[model samples]
Target: MKQSNFTTWFKSGSPWVWMNAGAVAIAVIMTLGLLILIAVRGLSHFWPADIVEAEYTIPGQPAITLLGEVTTREQVPTERLQGAGLPVDPEQNEFMDRELLKVGNRDLYGADFRWIVADWLSNERYPEDVIAIERREWGNFYGYLLSVSHDGEVVAEGEQAIDALQAAVERASGIYDEIHSLETGAIGKINTELERLRLRERGYELDNALTADRQAELEAERAVQNARYAELESELVDLYREFNRDSIMTRAMDGQEKRISLSAIVRVFQPNAMGITDKIGHYFAKLWEFVSDEPREANTEGGVFPAIFGTVLMVLLMSIIVTPFGVLAAVYLREYAKQGFVTRTIRIAVNNLAGVPSIVYGVFGLGFFIYFLGGNIDQLFFREALPSPTLGTGGMLWASLTLALLTVPVVIVATEEGLTRIPRSLREGSLALGATKAETLWKVILPMSSPAMMTGLILAVARAAGEVAPLMLVGVVKLAPTLPLNANYPYLHLDQKFMHLGFHIYDVGFQSPNVEAARPLVYATALLLVGVIASLNFAAVAIRNHLREKYKALEN
Candidate 1:
């Protein structure tokens, strides 16, 4: 039959193909753009930005010099500036350009950020002598190194002070590491052992078997731990004394001098003078520190190692729980059950469960997992730890279980689809070879469906990792005193609370006292969370691909 040009094009399907491809390309671009924005905002926070020294003048106010990094710049209406108590030139223009300076002498200025109209800034300079100091507390300090002192005596000055201060800082950092290890390692170990002994004594009391011999043994072990702790305490004291012996004197841009103890300093660098290579090295170092070190300064600064660890641990726990149960349910429904009304109703319920609000699951988790199941567990196994509510509290175990329940529907549906695809010939052939239905399902059907199982798992991991509301109610906390996994007895303590990267980002973005300082950290944390979830999914994808390849011949 003869056709018009439009009819011919429609029949070719080329237009639809092009439209689909364009839609996919746009989606890819948007996703990449978002990731690039996050990377730029978060990763740049680690780079040592050149510190600028500038003289700022405002009407009827004395000219003041400023030193620090230019953190933000934008244009604002002249009226807005006037409303904010800044003198604005009305005759000049409707809008005024402004810069926010991270003037890091927080101890002196009472704030880290300051805004000044760009027009009033003069004598802008990046001096090679200017140094930026990252302290253990009170944030950063930007100035010139005037001298390095030891025991209240000037040991080096001017150019020579840089080398001396670097050496002293290195030594102090080593001492700090030792002290940290002693506190969180040796002492932490001793404390865990002491706690175990206490719990053990309690257990014996509950059993009415508190024998004198057992008590004496525990006391003897505790005495040894005490002696070790005493020795470590003495060593820590010596380290602190050594660490505090050296300090640096720096001159602010306003010619004010301040002494900062070397022990309080985390790092010092000449950002204005740093070459590209130096900045790159410093950037990677800072990035590593952000991921490896424990958070400090109310979690607005430092690394989020605990959060990362907790997230991976909880997801792994959830995966372990959800996989078998999901597979079993799918097998029962798809393979064994008769096609009937009850089965159809059950399938509809499972599908509906997937659409339920996540916060509802959280409420269910708090009530059932924490209150009912946990209460019973505490009564049965941890009666001595009552009043304190050991297992009957929000914790990693309940959180993992709650997420498992939330994600099980996805896994069940995926597995059922896989089961239905395994040509009836294969199952019948297995049974024809003297195998029972259960045997054929176990060794044949399940192996062929492994790829689909992994697909479901990947989806579950992605969803569970990003879920914050449910975890907040079940287990996640602002800060966890100890990680779920540690070097203590029963290394994996599922009963303990844990930190999550999602919660960290939310808290730092909204709940932080220092909003300006925490803003960069929020972007960095969000990037890290995305990277973690991607890595997990990639691993699952690899396994899925391998399973698909292995089972391809069987299907054929």
Candidate 2:
């Protein structure tokens, strides 16, 4: 009876089907769980959490007052805490709850975070008068507003200080904008011209053509640019003076007063006093800034627009580069190559290359592309920039090419599979009707294969966006001084080094000096990277779907 029952169940095929369905369900649940965890830990960082003021007492130490935001909490058995050298009375408590606070006056407190026993906390309050200041240099400042001053004199005190300080910040912000504009715009133009003049003179010398007329022209241009530079410098000096004219005084929990320049401040907020509507507005504003601003403080704070731009730009360049080469190679192999031992061996090699490590491709690109090809180009055409190694360095161009090399096998294999799907009757019919074999393949075969090519591209993008190890050796950096793309001729600067979101996550998560401060940013950056890759894949998939629908008639 048991043998017959087993035979009947096996013959029904329901067991195998259930097993496959169960596996798929498990995968979906795991993926959603990961995304939810990432979202909660990352997106919640932008919200304006209420600050807590409390008194903490520990055994054998003086009772002290703590002022900051409660970032996290942990519970431990009293016996375990005692074993770890923390004095906890097991008779009084079975478990001790500890709260981690972000006490963000780093310059004053030596550290921005502290953990204390929550059971001992007393006089806990959320004071409405507390202020939080975000700065360009120091991580953050938390204190009570003391006074607002301008040029060594007090402008406002008491309840009016917040209003006065906000007005000063507005004026300082305008001046800061002027400074940035002058530096990046007019002065930047003059600097570029000066650089061009220098490069032109270098080229002439390298070519043995630095004649008297060329020398005179160079000097004349240099003098004009220098004069313009001097005028901009004078303007910059005045702006700096005005920018530093106002200051705000703040008192820490321990009653230590600090005078911070308005120029250094990014923003100031009274979180405890803000209503829910105000908090929501501020949260959205912060999210926008996170997506738009340049990173500061070792990439622990600020926006990652440069990284986002670089990742997208590099992937697009790789796509532009890989697609054509992959298609051509696949076409020759599938449609033109003689099918024999050599062809079989070449096919095996291509398939093997797909499994080669990405880092090996990065190394190959560095040696062959940068050192060999790029070095030769620099020597032949850019001799003037030889020592500076213009193209002969790991940069955006080489990075993209390396990724293209790494992902090209996938494209080739996919394209060949697509080409194979072209019905033999279509090719024969087109050839018989007056089209040559080339015309038949180009007009009838390639169009039907485009969807597969797009599928390959989607897979390539998904892999490339998350790659960090290869990029680190190729061109990615901890911090990029300037963006590769800017307001200049030939706006896409291929030879410039760039940042990647994947690398950003690695640096913030592992290389940061302040682990506690960088933890949230790492999660946020990781989530952003995942979103970016998914968006690219979705775009490619959409195109593939459209192409498939368009060419479905031909396939039939």
Query: Which one is best on lDDT?
Result: 1
Model 1 regions lying over 4 Å from their true place? 1-3, 7-17, 206-208
Which candidate number would show the highest TM-score if scored against the true structure?
2
Per-residue lDDT of 140-198 in model 2, one digit per residue for the tens?
89999999988989999999999888888878878988998899888887888888889
- What are the lDDT figures for the candidates, one per model? 0.91, 0.90
Model 2, runs deviating above 4 Å: 1-6, 77-80, 90-94
Tens-place lDDT per residue, model 1, 1-556, is: 4568779989899999999999999999999999999999998999898998888899889999988888899998998988888877666889989998899888877888888899999999999989998898888998899999899999999889888888888888999999988888888998888877888889899999999999999899989988998998898889889989998889887899999999989999998778999999999999999999889878877899999999999999999999999999999999889989999999999999999998999999999999999999999988777778887899999999999999999999998998988999999899999999889988999999999999899989999999999998999998887789988778899999999999999999999988899999999999999999999999999999999999999999
TM-score of 2: 0.97
Estimate the TM-score for candidate 1.
Answer: 0.96
Model 1, global lDDT: 0.91
